[model samples]
Target chain A: MAFRYPDGRKFEPKRNEMTKKSVNKDARFSNRGMTLEEDINETNEYYLAHQVAVIHKKPTPLQIVNVHYPSRSAAVVTEAYFQKPSTTDYNGVYKGRHIDFEAKETKNKLSFPFKNFHDHQVEHMKRVLDQGGIAFAILRFSYTDEVFLLEATHLIRFYEERDHTRKSMKKKDIEHFGYLIPLGFHPRIDYLKIVDKLITGS
Target chain B: MAFRYPDGRKFEPKRNEMTKKSVNKDARFSNRGMTLEEDINETNEYYLAHQVAVIHKKPTPLQIVNVHYPSRSAAVVTEAYFQKPSTTDYNGVYKGRHIDFEAKETKNKLSFPFKNFHDHQVEHMKRVLDQGGIAFAILRFSYTDEVFLLEATHLIRFYEERDHTRKSMKKKDIEHFGYLIPLGFHPRIDYLKIVDKLITGS
Candidate 1:
């Protein structure tokens, strides 16, 4: 359904309320039912609270076409169409370095498909990398319950070199070139630890 | 009336067409009839083309509620509402530095009101600054056709100290603390020049 709502005034004013009801129950309940997006958002919250970093997910872009104003105070979007994002989903700063990345979850057991990433996103990552910013991808294998932080350079390489026969990035190749993000309780996807390594090149 | 569409499929898929037709008639026509948003976008485009910087204005945030899939390939949002953004509008990397800011146009020539900035955006800017990113506000005085790049620290100082009957930052005060961004031909708002000075702290 492209993740839109059905009807009603569902304008959520969540500054810190996206996961306000979903978290702080217990550490064991970490990511029990949350999607990759939700988990990363929660992780970002934790980071913000601790002053660790300031990264944010860019909102889904929409080409708004129709609006119905019921009152002077509130505006309701009656019709809008999804637009292909020109860049990655997430970006921000950490320790004076620019951070940018895209998150994708795959149910496939052996590989992550190249179809998951758009060409412009790859190009955008390359540009970010060129500007001396940190660019990467967070790949989550749902079937195996594993996650890896792969640098954008490698992702771009796999993307550009993909042919009809090799439509997907192999799991082994991913593991070879990426760092397995440690699953944690507070921040579900602790990818910044890997990012720290990338920044210092340690 | 809140900048949503009126009717039809007005999905402008303009990766490069935002100012494609409006610009390049001549250098004298530079920002002759464009809005602040359009001008900044064109400037960012110029930056990208010149490999000068990689900056982007974040899309307006909305809480989409309902979507209809007319076909397997196309999904349309039939219901949604505007959500207050928790962060600033623009953020990116330039010269290996994390850059973040909010662009605002004021009709008032005497002062730029604190009302233009939301509480969350101010907090977000503060967080960005704390993370060692360069944060500022691009203030365009539409009445006078002048623009200024005001740093976050000074903006924050004015914001935090704002009180009853003194709800604005004066133009004189802004001129003292902010850099006057030059209006250019190719890039309508040449902000990175001031940013370069900021980076060197000269």
Candidate 2:
């Protein structure tokens, strides 16, 4: 059977398109244009290869309605639809603690809207936190090209306290509460550097 | 879109059919008849609700070949095929350590054939072990009604030591190397109790 991550294969041609300019250029110049999801996935692969962590992006949840067996060779999925994920986008083992996080990239200039996340994801994060797992969010501002790691506790607080006036997390607050992800070449966004700090409670 | 897990829904009717007989029955009788996958899913749900752990079964990996956007309601999957999983069946955090494992049930009383596991899953478990995460397999002997927790190291040894003669893991060898899971009413398989022991190194 064929194997492919939903968006993973879709990004390949685009990545290949960047080959000419990205090949010889420095790390930041080559990678700054990639999506946050791709960057994190590449980073996770690097960590896995290096034995640094076992983090993985969970597959997109789908509901298969009908399957047609054309022959013994293959069973084809004829009818299915996307299902909202019951948990965050990414999770895995990190330094003996359950590492869980949702990655979101926003085009808004001043703040990130609370609408970016679903209710179940917020609840899942809370449960993970209560279970003593490390929970957080990797947020990226598309226009400014800034990525920050915001701990779930702070995100939870903002979410719980949200009102019509306080609908989203402000950029200044994100800057104050979240750690900026150091972007580099090979692994791209090194969020684990921040995770190491989180592990040590520093 | 429906949020049903592949087998999760498939088993519901069978479980409903068992409600009358299983409702008043003892835990062992009630759960012993259930599939290992269902039991583990129910156990994980219990753990999550009680804040004991945040484990989850990874969804079956499928390669989507085509999608049909019929109106704005839902995008229907027109073509897809099941793919080999790149990791174990289940993983999560337990008492501050990463827990990763595969669960299998076999009708064979003599042994569990090594062919039950895919190459990628074994490699994934090894990587998890090297990264200091907990890795193991939960094997249930169906005919004899026995369950054992075999650590990845032992399983790895059995796998690597295999020749044409040693095609499978003998039940006797498994009983010697693996720990019997203490099953219970609410959780069905209390594998974490075994995990607690592993963490303490006692």
Candidate 3:
């Protein structure tokens, strides 16, 4: 199928067609073009390889319908549909603590919109927090290339207050409540350093 | 696409055509005929609803090759292949501990085969244990209706010693090293009670 952007624009899958100049531009901009999810995945891989943490991104849920098995080949899934995820995107163990979080990126410079997340995700995060797990969101302001580790409690409060307040969270509110995550080269996004501070207060 | 069992038997999709007597047999046996994976899933669901724990089975990974999108509804995956899982089947947070485990059942009354697991899964479990997460395997003896939570460390030892020792672990060794998980109605398998004992030793 033809891949489409959120705005309904057809997304060409030929990423290799991009010019070297654009690639250099991306490098110079500290990977401003890369998605937050990609950066987090790279970070998780680095962590796993280094024996620093055991974080992993959960596989995308798919409801398989029909599968065909050939005589001497791998089975092929012929019909399937994507299912809505019931839990957070990333989870693992860090210093014996259960770490759970979702990573999200938004182009909006003034505020982070609530539409980027679902109600079930928020509820799942709340349950994680209640169970003594460290639950949060890695929020990335794509336009500015700034990332923050916002605790689940803060997000939950804003989500519950949506009935009376604006649907989006202001940048000032995020700056006040969230901890800034320093970007790096090896791990790309060092959100765990922020987690360290959250755990040790050091 | 047609479904088939691992033994090369073509699976007819008409599950509803089963006789009532067979259904009665299934019900009377307390779902003993069901796969261990299915029982664990039901147990996980029960745990989630009762706020006992928040474990979940990760969806089977699929490598999508082709998809079809109609103008109005969700996109349907037209061609895909199941990818080998890199980690264990189940994981979640329980009482502030990161719980990670794989569940396997063997009809053999003598031993559980080591070939049922992959190398990457063992490596993943090792990482979990290194990070202080609770890592184990839920071994089910289908014939005896006995389930045991064998710690990952024990499994790793047996796995690494395969060159010198037997490729499979005897049931006697498992009975000595593993903690038996009691079967129940609400949670179905009370593995956490074993976990609590493992934690507190009380």
Candidate that scores best on TM-score: 1
What TM-score, computed on C-alpha atoms, does each candidate reach? 0.88, 0.84, 0.86
User: What 10-residue stretch in candidate 1 chain A is worst by lDDT?
Assistant: A8-17
Which DockQ-derived CAPRI band holds candidate 1?
A: acceptable
The per-model DockQ list reads 0.37, 0.30, 0.38
Which parts of model 1 have CA positions greater than 4 angstroms off?
A1-30, B3-30
- Computed on alpha carbons, the lDDT of every model, listed in order, comes to 0.81, 0.77, 0.79
All candidates' chain B TM-scores are: 0.85, 0.84, 0.84
Off by over 4 Å in 3: A1-30, B1-30
Better of 1 and 3 by TM-score: 1
**Global fold similarity of model 1 (TM-score):** 0.88
Across A1-202, the per-residue lDDT of candidate 3 in tens digits comes to 2444334444332222222333445544566566677688889999999999999888776666666777544576687666667898899999999999998888899899887677888988887877788999999998888999999999999988875468899888999999888898889998899999888862
* lDDT minimum window of 10 residues, candidate 3 chain A: A11-20
Better of 1 and 2 by DockQ: 1
Per-residue alpha-carbon lDDT of candidate 1 for residues A1-202, written as tens digits (9 for 90 to 100): 1232233112222233222443445643645645677788989999999999999999877777666777555667787766677999899999999999999888899999987788889999999999989999999999877999999999999999999899999999999999999898888888999988987873
- lDDT accuracy of residue A85 in candidate 1: 77
Question: Any idea what lDDT model 3 has?
Answer: 0.79
Model 3 lDDT tens row, B92-122: 9998889999998888998998877778999
Clashing pairs in 2: none
